[model samples]
Target: EVVRQYKLGLARHVNEHTGRPLSRATQTYFLVALRSLLRYWAMQGLDVLAPDRVELGKAPSRSLKFLDGDQLRRLLDAPDINDLRGLRDRALMETFFSTGLRLSELARLDRDHINLRTREFGVIGKGRKPRIVFLSDAATNWLGRYLQARQDRWKPLFVRMKGKPDLAPGGPGMRMSTRSIERLVGKYVRLAGLGVKATPHTLRHSFATDLLSNGADLRAVQEMLGHANLNTTQIYTHVTNPQLRAAHRKFHSGNRE
Candidate 1:
């Protein structure tokens, strides 16, 4: 009874809540928690809800959100090159789009993690697995510039400000936080006036979409994105639907309309 009521309540909240509907991703988390509880009860010899009987609601197929080439150029250009902060922001944005790194992976980057000559680096992704991410020529150039302009001996790849009054005694100038990266991305996104709610994750989406659109193999994309499951990488396949439509219109002999 408790399980039934909990399931129904979750469905109602997801379907007709006052605030924003809880995303399917969020719902899956809730379901997993419930399943764990039920499994515990079953292990204790209780005749409570069966964990195996619990099913997660299907997540809707949502299209990927990404900026086009022009929009990307505009965003990269939004940060002023003359200023140190702008230089850092531009490099950060370029790296996000080029490497498709998760926020945490990017946040934890240390100065020694990247080799400018090689332009390739390894990141510890989810599940504590290490994977390689390469920087594009453009990304490399911007990052090189940012590194050259840095006067501080900060240990982090990206940091707040040098000699700032509010900077933590030994904290602020260390590693850049994930939230700070998001704010930097947001600031440039607004300045570029793309007019879409884009986050750092959107840049990651753009990286995958660009690769798939340009005929990169699915398996290669999966490896590059460091997706543990192939299904996670398959999301980019949906974003390529427009290219599929174009090909169909151009080559299909039966469809002359």
Candidate 2:
């Protein structure tokens, strides 16, 4: 009864950050932590409710924030390609959308890690798992242009055009940090006037959604995104289901609507 009451209290608990009722996921997190503590106490011979007695509420479906085709095109075009920095920015954005790589994964890349001819490379993603990432022709073209324009030996795939003293021709200091990449994405997001909050991860979402919408397999997407579990990749299915329904409506012989 105490556990039931506590669950009810959590349901009504207000979040200090959002000024709203605690989300089901957050409630689950709290409950899980409490359950672990209870289990620890029980192991120590203390009289406490069994952890199994604490039932978790169902979490709401995830809402994905991704750019649509038009928005993506606009965002990609946001950078001034004629300029060196702009060219680098364009390449970075293109690579993000093409590879569906995490910000850290992209930032950790080196020039030697990529193969322009094959347009594919291996990356160590979450959990230290290695997966292959492929580059689109556009990404390849932009990257080639950016690298060619550099005209210097830089080991890092992407580097700051200007800032900080020049250490060596191939030094880690020249590499762009993940935070810098985030700010770069934000700058273009504003310039594109997307009217939607987006980050580098948004491009990853867009990449997954774009593939699924165009009939790519879910498992394939999971591998491409280097997800540890298929369930993590399944979140994108919610975004693609509507497109599937539309396709069914158009092609199904028994369609009445």
Candidate 3:
């Protein structure tokens, strides 16, 4: 009953999101989550109706939020590297741009996951699949700066702010949560003063977009992103420069001649 109540509650929640019904993507995700919760509870012998039976309204036709070229440049330069916190943030941003590591994959990384010498990183992506992401020269540079000032003497590549960096300090192993990663990216987005809506996942979108714009193959992008399905990678093709030009040439009044 509580699950059903929440399902009904989503209408009002969706209203707050866009003053309209939930977009198809959002509704599908909501239904999936509700169904999963119902399944878990039912397996425990609890009585509950499955959310899959609920009719999803419709999904809004909208493009994913992404950084434009100029905005991306500004975002990459947003951090103040003189301080420890800034260095860590810059490294996170750079690594995300260089290799579209999902938030969880990044959070799970320890020092061992990264090979500083070879400029490559190991990430266990979706479905526990492992893939290697190369570190760009810029990533290597910031990482070195961050590591040089490091005092944790621990494996976690990034650390939250604590009192002073003690070269040999007494502390437990700390790793940032997925939410923290989101907020950290948000901080830089604001600092960059791009005035664009963005989050950590923005970097991933930027990675895929940049690759498509540069003419990378769909299969190659799929592999780098650790996607099991090639069709999933096809979305980038839809947003490529060639497609954009074709669309304009076909529909624009100025180019229609």
TM-scores of the candidates are: 0.63, 0.65, 0.61
RMSD (Cα, Å) of candidate 3?
A: 15.8
Q: Once superposed on the true structure, which residue ranges of model 1 sit more than 4 Å away at CA?
A: 1-64, 162-173, 230-257
Instruction: Give the TM-score comparing model 1 with the true structure, all chains together.
Output: 0.63
Evaluated at residue 119, the lDDT of candidate 3 is: 67
- Arranged by lDDT with the best first, the candidates are 2, 1, 3
Give per-residue CA lDDT, model 2, range 1-257, as digits (tens): 88888889988888665578965544654565566667778989999988878776543445325677889889999999898899999999999988889999999999998888866677887767676666776788899999888876878998887777466768878899999999999999999998778889888877766665443545555567776643442323113234333432332211221
Q: Give residue 146's lDDT in candidate 2 (0 to 100).
A: 91
* Positional deviation of residue 120's Cα in model 3 after best superposition, in angstroms: 1.4
Number of clashes recorded per candidate:
0, 0, 2
* Residue 92's lDDT in candidate 2: 94
TM-score of model 2 vs. true structure: 0.65
lDDT, residue 150, model 2: 83
Question: Which is the better candidate, 1 or 2, if ranked by lDDT?
Answer: 2
Q: Which digits, one per residue and each the tens of the lDDT, describe model 1 over residues 137-224? A: 7778889999999876667888876455334543545677788888888888889998777888878767765654443444555566
